[model samples]
Target: MAYTSLYRRYRPDTFRDVIGQEHIVRTLVNQIKSGNIGHAYLFTGTRGTGKTSVAKIFSRAVNCLHPVDGSPCGKCEVCLELALSGNFDILEIDAASNNSVDQIRELTDKINFPPTIGRYKVYIVDEVHMLSKSAHNALLKTLEEPPEHAIFILATTEVHAIPATILSRCLRFDFRLVPTSAIAARIRFIFDEIGVEYEEQAVNMIAAAGQGSVRDALSIADMCVSFCAGNVTYDGVMEVLGTSDPVKLVGFVGNILSGNVDEALKTVAEMCDSGKSMAILASDVAALLRNAIYVKTCETAAEILSLPEEQCAALRALGEKHSVQKMLSVLKTMTATEGEFRYSTQHRILFESAVISAATEAPAAGTTAKERELEQKIAQLERKVQALAKPGFKSAPAKEDAVQVWARVASELQKKGAAFIALAATEAEVESDGGVFRVKVGSSSCMKILTDKSNRDLLNEAFSSVCGQKLVIEEVKKLDEDKSLPYITSMFGKYLEIK
Candidate 1:
């Protein structure tokens, strides 16, 4: 016999054999047993969730000559023929390929004839929503009232794409995505049956990576088995998935929470060099941050995370080191950067920038270790500056001939149309510390003129020449409430000028 894939080889033979979707399987089995089967059945769900598989089993049960309770007796001639030779009455059509009106019309005409061997003529149309509008309309009347010997089973991943008229006549059954635990159990059973040795963490990783799809889980497991060559390990799965190592990712998080920017950036660059896709890396970073946030708020460990025990223990330690607010902020940055990466030409640049930017964002509202370090540094710097000053030199340093200096600087600045002077003082106070000068602009209109970089540079150079010190000039933002009346008076003054 030819080799068959694991999913097909282990396909559910009966309702009892089905994993997950117990409610749906039970309802279907009971309907078949009670002879309450509908003319048209619509099965909808995500891909690889067993919609079509259940449809096939239901069709066989309904047509089996020697049925066993609610299931088909696989030994029966009708069931065996249908399963092996593909019975004429039990027709399976791919609506995606034969979606034209002509094909549907031919199918509708064929439905008028009775079953050749089975009790009912069953038409299983997979991906039924792919049918064109005309094709759907052509089948609508037939679907609403088909022959007594005919049954239509429509299966689709997208139910909304099918018209309401076509959907109204059918009994809809929604198949859910198999849960992680259920999928993992099935995989574990299969691995054991195949005599494959695998790590528990590897199975759990594959299950979670599947995202609630049994087929996806199986596909990933298959890849792991082949790559490991008998021993399915978590490291093998990670290598195949090209995902950042959980250990390295946790270490990266620790470095970040400890405010080790250099180490964090280095790790990020290393990940990029390892050919890890930025999008996947960002997703992993976001997941790690989310777990940290959960741990910080919930104060629960091991029991909360569904991963292997060792991984959960490491995440719990990280949760203690980082605040919930900080983790949430990091998650937001990663998520936002993931969106930008869609059209980004320089994803590495974008990812690096996002990481650096996240490092500078505010932490939780409480005091943190990073804040304590900054405060300590600021205090030390303040003491150093205090020590540098002469003892008891508290009085304001001698006001240099600032009045004379400003007059000269003011003349130089005036040449550049900055006709302004300090408002607080006639001259500036200068010493080894720095220069402090106040400008008096009799008219607020000249604020922009004095603030211009060119004029500011001229004044600074003129002052430095006279006072022998380098200085920085800062412009104060005048309060709106303090200047609102002046603007009102200016408007009236403009009116006077016009008059």
Candidate 2:
């Protein structure tokens, strides 16, 4: 006989065996005990959350001749009869393949027929949201008012795709994502039953890789079991899931938080060379950073993170050495980069760039003394610039020529916070005639800045202070079409040299 997969081999057979869905289980068990089962029920949630599993269990319990606490005894005549593959009392339908209007009509046509062996004829339609509009309309009336002997259980992962009309007619039960701890416990039980040797951390890793899906988790566990040759280990699990080691990930995050770009990139290069995917690496790093933040801020982080004590200690050490803000910034960068991987082919480059960016933005504690020194020098320069812009600064003598007078005015403007205007005016030509000053600038941007009211007022005040009299300011244009010389030389050719 062929080997059965772990998920199928360990599928929940009864409501009692279902994990991580107590709310729905309690309600269904009560309904089964009270005989108040609804005609139509809708089970919705993410895959592997026990919607279909619960539906099958409930179907069996309802038809069981002897139900113990709302669960099928599995030994009664009705239970035995319904357990057969050929039984007509409980039917499982894959709505994905049989989603046409005719298929739905055929199902509705048989609803009036009473159960052959059980009290209710249960129809379990998995992925019911895939049904066509006409098919949904065809089954609407039958679902809304099925005969007393007929029951409908519609299971779907995407509940929003289900029409509101159909949704309103059915009793809805939402299944949540199974917790990692619950999944880990279940894996441990399954491994014990099968006599599979595994490390505790390895089992937890497998459970987390499942991402709250029992089937997905079990599928990964199956691979791990086979790959490890019956002795599952943490390294084996990491290899199977394509994730990094938690200790290495913690160290990688440490490099980032401490602004060690070289070490961080070296780790990334090593992972890439070993055939690890950049996208998965980014996700792992992000999850580790998030956990570190929880350890830093949350009081009960040990309980919340669900990681092993050793791993938590490492994260706690990392969190204690770094601020929450720096970790959050790195986490944000990594998450944003993960989204971009879908659109680009250069995954390694993008990942490396994000790592370098995060490391570069690390807090002051991460900066080198030389970098801090440079930052201080920059601050000093800014203060000097601000100081030079103060009032009461003297200018050139009043006896200076128009060129010298204009140079003095430009220097004063540079000191008074009009640096751009002062720089642009350096290339312009100035002339003084009858106590009127005319200026000509080549570039339109420079002209606009020079013509501004604030800049114009600065220019006028500088001229008044330098030339000992207020001069009328006028902007002029060049009429001589000489393109050989530069703008400055063309305007100030006789006064200046080409050099």
| CA displacement after TM-score superposition, residue 302 of candidate 1 (Å) | 13
Candidate 2, residues 1-499, lDDT tens digits: the string is: 9999988899888888999999999999999999998989999987888888899899999989889999999999999888898677787776655324333344443556778898998989888765554456555756656678878899987575577899999999989768778999999999999999999999988887676678888999999999999999999998887668988889999999899999999999999999988988887888788678767666665654455667778998998788666787898798778667877999999999999999999385554677447545543433333233221111111111355456667767877878777776665555555446666554445677777888878877776777653465444432222322232222112333333
lDDT of 1 by residue, 61-115 (tens): 9998877868888988888788765456787776655324333434444556678
The lDDT for every candidate, in the order shown, is 0.66, 0.75
Candidate closest to the true structure, highest lDDT: 2
Estimate the lDDT of model 1: 0.66
* Model 2 ranges with Cα > 4 A deviation: 99-108, 261-266, 277-279, 294-317, 332-357, 362-499
How far in Å is the alpha carbon of 227 misplaced in model 2?
1.1
TM-score of 2: 0.66
